[model samples]
Target: MTFVTSEPYIGHMGLGGIGDSKGLLESELRKRHIKWVDNARVTSVDQDKVNVEQLDEKGRVANTHELPFAYSMLIPPFAGVDAVQGIEGLVNPGGFILIDKHQRNPKWPNILAAGVCVAIPPSRPPRCLPAHRRPD
Candidate 1:
């Protein structure tokens, strides 16, 4: 089984920062022998193979390769669900749910959200999204 994701880090939950949890996750993946590819973009998928496009340091496509799979599960990028997506005030421009200090929708206080779709700024760089908690 192969899990492909664009981001490098694993265990993106709030309790452990991206740096801390990845060691454990990587160790376990090594123990179980799972192949983890970071910073990869899947260009296409077919019955027998998935085509991957890897970029060079200059932000150009450096290599394209095919990965074979007997059974593969693809978890694409998380977007706000269709239910609340694109509603004028409910979501941000990127379609992440807009929440207040309580993680409840600011405009509609009764609505609460959790998981990958909540709008939190990246902590490290220009673009990254890790789970953010209210600091309990």
Candidate 2:
């Protein structure tokens, strides 16, 4: 089996990784003989093949790979529904529902949410540098 991900490294899982997940997942994949490609961008997907561009440290295309598959699943970034947009305290700027300790909406006591629909703050700051340079 082959695994492709946009994450900078295996096991990042888009949340800066959980403790030891990087090592553990890498070990498991290796033991199972699963081939993986990280830092990848899916340029296109056809019926039988997926075209991917692997990026480098400077965000340049390092290599392009065409992976053929009989079946595939793509998990994109999560987002809230349009119906929940602009609901003030009930939702975050991205529209994901805001939940408290009980997974209940702060604005509406009767409402609750779960799954990807719930807003989760980043566990760590982003790794990217700022977009603009500071003045001397």
Candidate 3:
């Protein structure tokens, strides 16, 4: 099996990862003989192949890979509801509600955002990879 992700490295899990997650997940994938492509962007998907662009640290395509798979699963990118979108200072570009430490919107203090609608910035910036954007 092959794993493809936009994460700068393994186990980033979009939260800059937990402790040792990189090492642990890498070890496990190695043990299982599973391959992974990091900083990957899926350009297209066909019946038997997934076209992926392997991006370099500069956010440029370093290589293009045609990965063949008998079965594939894709987890679409996340986004906040339409109601919160386009509200400047209230949400990020992807529309996820921007919240303070207390889960309150900074610009709209009276409004509270919870659950998946809340935006959690990565603990650290990705080397050069762009933030995950919802598909158009």
Which number leads on TM-score?
A: 3
Model 2 error, position 30 (Å)? 0.9
Q: Which consecutive 10 residues in model 3 have the weakest lDDT in total?
A: 127-136
lDDT (Cα, 0-100) at 49 in candidate 1: 97
TM-score of each: 0.66, 0.66, 0.86
Model 1 vs. true fold: TM: 0.66
lDDT scores for all predictions? 0.70, 0.84, 0.89
Q: What lDDT score goes with residue 56 in model 3?
A: 88
Candidate 3, residues 1-136: lDDT per residue as tens digits? 9999988889998788889999999999999999999988999999999999998888889999999989999998767888879899999998999999999999999999899888898777665645673222
Residue-by-residue lDDT tens digits, candidate 2, 1-136: 7899988888786676778888999999999999999988899999999999998866899999999999998888566878989999999988999998899998997999998888875565434434454222
Q: List runs of model 1 lying over 4 Å from the truth.
A: 12-19, 56-59, 104-117, 126-136
Ranking by lDDT: 3, 2, 1
| Model 2 segments more than 4 A misplaced | 86-94, 98-115, 130-136
Query: Ten consecutive residues with minimal summed lDDT in candidate 2?
Result: 127-136
**Candidate 3's C-alpha lDDT?**
0.89
